[model samples]
Structure formats: structure tokens, C-alpha cells
Target: MTTPGHLYLVPAPLDFGCAVQSPLTDALPDATLRAAAGITHWICENAKSARAYLKRIDAIHPLATTIQAQNIVELPREVHKKGDHHGGFDARPLLAAALQGHDVGLLSEAGMPAVADPGSSVVRAAHDLGLAVKPLVGPVSLLLALAASGLNGQNFAFVGYLPQDATERTDRIRALESIALRTGQTQLFIETPYRNAALLQALVASLQPNARLSVSWGLTLPDGRTRSADVKTWKRTPAGPDNQTPAVFAIGR
Candidate 1:
């Protein structure tokens, strides 16, 4: 019987597409970098970004295979738009390399793969296929934001992105706030860098006056900052995350 290779969940730095990037060594453990360096096959969100990330890794750890020789497969674009967490996407095909006894890396553009990211299907498929799944130590923005928020980290939920439509977004924020207020569960979500300020406005306008709001941006970068305050305080200071950087938003009592 052939031994199947393990699937390594390789996390990329949080600085993807940001104005400033943090050193990988600063955010990722040596073991993770070494493990990622040894994998020659990958199933990634975007092949181009994956290559770019690999190039960065090569600078420090020296990839086992040259960038051109790496067998990199991108997850379908549809999976990027409509998430793969619901099990609708079949990811076993992507794991052919691993089935053949070649270790494979699963990467997202930023943070951990499958957490607030699109690679859950691949990880789920690995488990179903009897492949060992290993998640490496790395920075996960949601957890970082939650830890810094001073909110109820004991019980929190990452609700992904909020609705884009004005009324719907406000309504959604209110619903999330209701749960946070009533149960002390921290509500976490994110917004595209460009829509960040707008979402902050909607969040401020919708959450109860006493509800705590935490906005974390530029995480892991030199300019990284997390601001937490009640809705009233946030309203008093209307400035929020600028439109150029990734941000994580959280609300709770």
C-alpha cells in the first residue's frame, strides 16, 4: 500500500496587497517556513499570488524546487467568489499530488488557509481521502483582532463579510450586535480594503450606543493598529480605517 503524503496548511503573511509588507520571519515560525519550503506541490487560491509568495519564501528558506519547476494548481475562481466551506466544491482532484506520495501545500493569499479563506474544501477533502492534515503556526487576522479587541474572546464568531447593500448591511450589523449584546459572544467580520470606511460608518450607525466596536487594520505591519471603543465614542471620532488596508471588525457588549 502506498503511503499518502500529508497536506500542509501554509499560511501567507497578512501583508498581501498592502502598502507595506511584514517580514515572513516576523510573523511565521521557523518550522512553518521550513515545512513550506520543502513542499513542491501546492493547491492555492491564486497561482500567481502563490508563486509570488513562494518567491518570497525562497528568498529566506530556499524552496525545494525552483519556482518554475513547482507544481502549483489554483483553486477555481468560482470558489473564490462563492466560498467552498459549504462542501459544494469537490477538492479531491486537487490532492492528486498528495495521493501519489508528494507532499502538498495549501495556501491562501493572506492569513491561514480555510479560516475566513477559501481552502476549507481542500482541507475537508484531505480528511475524507485519509490524507493527514497539518495546520502550521502563523498569524490569523481574526484571532489577532479578537485578542486585541478586549472583547469576549472566550466565545466569539467570525461571521465573514457583511452585506454590501446599505439597508441590508445595516440590518445585518444590527442582528449581529443583538446576538453580541444578548449573549456576550464577540461578533467578528471583515471588509474589502476599499469598503472599510463605509462599513465602519454603517457599523457605527447601526450598533447600539453602548456596544463595543473594535477595528483592526494593517495587522503585522509596522503601522498595524487596533482601535476599540463604544459606538458613542466611535461616533464622536468619526475617522476609521482608511480605504487602502485590510481591516478586521468586531462588536460586543
Candidate 2:
């Protein structure tokens, strides 16, 4: 029996502009960087971005002697739009390198792959094929936000992105708020960077006056900020400049 190569789930820095926002060494652990540097074969959400990330890491800790472009396979754009499990798409083929005895790395644009990000299908495929899967230590924005939010971390659900439509978004906010209020379960979600202010407004307007809301922005970056308060208190506070930075939003009792 041939031993299969391990599948390493590599996490990327929260911000691609590592040179500007924060040092790459600070965003990811040394072990993760070393693991990433050793894997030449990779399945990533975007080939270009993944290469750029690898290049950055290589600069920090030299990658395999000769990392080539052809070694990285990009996840379909459809996967990014829909998700890895959409229509039960089989991702086994992407792990061909691993099956062939070459250790493979799975990378997402930011944070850990397959956690509130694309690449779950590849992880599932690894399991189905009896390949070993390992996750390296890294920064996860959701958990960072939750920890800083001072909310119920023991019981929480990451609901992913909320609705974009105005009415639907408002309704979704109310429903999530209801759950948080009733069960003390923290409800977590994210919005497009540009839509941060708009969602904050909608959240404040839709949730009960006493319901608590937590907004974390620029996590892991120098200007990172997390603020939590009741709807009424949030409404009284003057809004800051519109944040175009990536952010996490959560609500809990």
C-alpha cells in the first residue's frame, strides 16, 4: 500500500498588504510559515493571490527550492461564488498531487481555509480518500472578533454573510437578534468592506433598543478596533468615518 501525502491547510495573513498593515511574521505562526514554505503543490482560491502569498512567505522563509506556477491549482470561480459544497462538487481530483505522494497545501484568500471560507470540499475529499489532513496555527478574524467582543464565546454560530437586499437584510438582522436575545448565543456575520456602514445602520435600526451589537474592524492591523454596546447606545454615539476595511459583526445578549 502506498502512503498518501498529507494535506496541510495553510492560513494566510488577514490582510494581503502585509508590508503596510502588519508584518507577515506577526500574522501567522512560525510553524505555519515553515509548513507553507515546504509545500510546493497547492490548491488555492485564486492562483494569482496564492502565488503572491507564497512569494511573500518565501521571502520570509524560503519555500521549496523551486516553487513553480504550474504547481498551484485554483479553485473554480464558481466555488468562490457559490461555495465548495455547492451541488456536491467532487474535489478529490484537486488532491491529485497528494495522492501521488506530494504533500499539498490548501489555501484560502484570508484566514484558515474551509472555515467561513472556500476549500471545505477539498478537506472533505481528503477524508474520503483517506489522506491525512493537518491544520496549522493562524489568525482567524471571526474568533478574534468574538474574543474582543466580550460576548458569549461558549455558544456562538457564525452565520456567514447576511442578506444584501435592504428589507431582507433588516428581517435577517431581527431574526438573528431574536435568537441571540432568547438563547444568549452569539450571532456572528460579516459584510463587504464597503457595506460596513450601511449594515451597521440597518443593524441599529432593526434590533431592539437594548439588544447588544459588536463590530470589529481591521482585526490584526494596527488600527484594529472592536466596540460593543446596546442598540440605543450605539445610536447615540456619532458614527466614525465609513470603514472600507474588512470587519466582523456580532450580536448577543
Candidate 3:
């Protein structure tokens, strides 16, 4: 009786039994449980995660095993390039998935999609197609870093990943530093895992000495560390947690 065309935009939480590594399996429990022992459509941010998830969860038959988790990597790939991440640019998969009349759930690799993730495209497409996009509440990295930063959370902007190039990144930081100083709004963004040190160095060089910087790494996970210190002190002596992948960074005036 339920329309198969309906789409559910689910959000996977940020933790795994408070475990060491929160893999896709750890995140899928809520979605699978909510699928009501039956499913037919799921669109995952990463193909590997979806496959690994299916292996662990024992899905029911017909409405259960028939549930297919399609890897929507290429959908995001159409807009995956750097600098063009403002989003709302692509809608092919969202359209295709909706046209198929499958109640699709758009999931990100880690945190809630569309905030700073790639699922926004699918969400927008669903809206255009007049399909219901149900959101399953879950963890978000932006809010996670903001709450821990000890900065004024009343206002903030999540800039996602910062520029990788030195000159452009520095210029962008200069502009954001001025805004942070004037508006007192926290400026939060992330860099590639390995480039943590470099991004921190850029912050030190670009921001004012008196400006406050909150560096949160490995949020909501084992070895999680967060530090809010003056830019001057943080720069003179930079030291904090070490992470290999999946990191977050935030800086405020």
C-alpha cells in the first residue's frame, strides 16, 4: 500500500557503541531498524560502505533482502571537484532514483548529509520531483565542533573543507578573520587529515594574535581532543591530537 517512489533521507549518527572506529555498519543500525524489517532502496555516499553494511545486517526477504543500496558515488562525483562545492548543481541521480519510485534514503559517508556533506544534491532533486524525503536524525560534525569549541555558538558558519592552495587559503582566511573579528561569529572549517599541521600554521599566520582559535580533532571518538586557545599561544607552540583521516577544525575571533 505504501508508495515505492517515496524517498527517505536518513542521517547516520556519529558514533559506534562509543567504539574505536565508527564504520558504516555502526551508522546503519538506525536506518535498518527504521526500515521496518523491509527495504528496497538506499543511496549511500560511498559504495564500499554500503556493501560492507549489507554484509553485516541480516535484511528480511522480499521487502527485506530485495532492498537495494545503490552506490551514488558518481552522483556526487559530478560536483566533487574543489571550489564548486556550493552545491545544488547536479540532480541526475536524485531524479533517476526518484523516477524509479523507490523510497530512497540519501546517506553520507559519516555525518548527516546536506549540511556539509554531498547529500544536498539528492535532497534538492527529491524536492523538485515532489517526492517525500524523510530525514532520520543523526550526528553532525559542524555542531559537534561548535559545542566543544567553547566559543559563542549563537552564530556560526560551517565552511566545510578549506582551500588547499596556500595563497588562496591564506586570502580566504584573511577575509574570514576580519569577519570573525567584526561579527564575533565562529568560522569553522576542515582540512585534509594529513594537512592538519599546515592548516593550523595558516591560521596562525593569517589570524590576529589576539583572535581565539578552537582546534577540535577526532570529535566524538576515542582519542578525541579539543583545545581553545589564543591564536598567539597556539601559534607559538602548536601541539594537539594526531589524526590520519576524518578530521574537523574550527577557528573563532
Candidate 4:
């Protein structure tokens, strides 16, 4: 019987779609780059983005196969929109290459796969197929924001994207605030890059005066910044994440 190949959870830099992209070496560890460079088969969110990431890696460590020579399979568009964690998506078929004893890399556009991004189904499928799953050391924006935020990092929850409706969004914000304040647990969430400023405003307006809010943006880039303060202080000082950049928001005592 042929031994199944391992699935490497490769993390791309957080600067995806940003105006300025940080060098991969600066954001990813040398070992991760080496591992990524050696993988010739991949299951990725987008084939184009995966090629771009591999090109960046090739500049540092030569790839085992040329970008054009690599076998890349992209997840379905519906999976990207609705997410794959609920078990609706069948990712086992995507692992045929791994089952054939060819190592496969699982990649997302940014940060770690299957964390804030859409690749959990692939990881779950790998486990079910009895293939080794290896996650390389890399930056995760949620944890980076949580660690930078002086909130209750020990007890925190990443609630994903909040509601889009104004009223529902406000209601959800208050509910999370209550949990953060009452249980001393940090509430973390992300917003569409364009809506970041508006969300920050809503968070500042909806949260209680004593509740703390933290916003971290451009995490691994040179212009990266993190600001944390109470709601009342935020209202007075008026600071927030850049509207065009990816950000992580947290609320707690």
C-alpha cells in the first residue's frame, strides 16, 4: 500500500490585496518558506493568488517545481462565499493527489488557512483520509490583534463577521459587549476592509463608556498599527483602523 502524503497548511502573508505587500521572508519563518517551496501540489482558495504566493517564495527559496509546472486546484467559489466549516463542502475529492502519495499544500489568500479564512473543509478531509496534517509557524491576524489588545486574551472568542444591517449589527455588538464585560472574555471580529471605519464608529457608539475597544490594521507590514482604548476615550480621541486596510477588532473589559 502506498503511504499517503502529508497536507501542509501554508499561511500567506496578511498583506493580500493591500497597496503594499511585505516581503514573504519578513512575515514567514524560514522553515515555513522552505516547506512551501518544496510542495508541488496544492489546494488553494484561488489559483492566481496561490501562484503569486509561490512566486514570492521562489524569490527566496527556489521552488521544487516551476509555478507553471505545479498542480493547483482551487476551491469552488460558493465555498469561498458561504465558508466550508459547516461540513456542507465535500473536500475529500480535492485530496486525490495526496492519496496518490504526492504532498499537498493547503493555502488561503492571507493569514492561516481554516482560521479566519476558508479552508477548514480541506483540513477535515485530510484527517478523515488518514493523511498527516502539518501547520507551519506563521502569523495569525486574530491572535496578533488579541495579543496587542490589552483585553482578556486568556478567555476570548472570534465571532467572525458581525451583521450587515445597522440595527442587527448594533444589537450584536451590545450582546458581545455584555459577554466581554460580564465574563471578562474578549470578543474579536473582523469587518470588510472598506467597512472598517464605519464598524469602528458603530462599535464606539454602541459600546458602554467603560468597555474597551481594540483595532489593529496592516498587521505584518511596515505601516501596521494597533490602537486600544475605552469607548469614551475613543469617542473623544477619534481613532480607528484604516478604511482600505484589513483589520481585526476586539472588545472587552
Q: How well does candidate 4 score on lDDT at residue 49? A: 86
Candidate 2 vs. true structure, TM-score: 0.95
When 2 and 3 are scored with TM-score, the better candidate is: 2
Query: Regarding lDDT, does 2 or 3 come out ahead?
Result: 2
Tens-digit lDDT string for candidate 2 (168-252): 9998999999999999999999987878889998988898998999998778888778999888999999373245678899999
Model 4 scores a C-alpha lDDT of 0.93
Off by over 4 Å in 2: 17-19, 67-70, 85-87, 238-243
Clash counts per candidate, in order, are 0, 0, 7, 0
The lDDT of each candidate is: 0.93, 0.87, 0.65, 0.93
Per-residue lDDT of 1-253 in model 4, one digit per residue for the tens? 9888999999889999899998888899999999999999999989998999899999999999899999999999999899988897889999999999999999998999999889999999999999999999999999999999989878999999999999999999999999999999999999999999889889988999999999999999999999999999999997777778999999999
Q: All candidates: CA RMSD in angstroms?
A: 0.8, 1.7, 4.0, 0.8
lDDT tens readout by residue for model 1, 1-253: 7789999999999999997888899999999999999999999988899999999889999999999999999999999999998989999999999999999999999999999999999999999999999999999999999999999989999999988999999889999999999999999999999999899888888888999999999999999999999999999997777999999999998
| lDDT of candidate 3 over 1-253, digit per residue (tens) | 5343766655654442233665444434555445623444566666666544444444421235532543333345655453224654766555564576656656665667666766676676777777877766556777877898888799888877777889999999988878888899888888666787888778888888888988876665657778888888987788864546455667676
- What lDDT score is found at residue 112 in candidate 4? 97
Residue-pair clashes, model 3: 7
TM-score of each: 0.98, 0.95, 0.80, 0.98
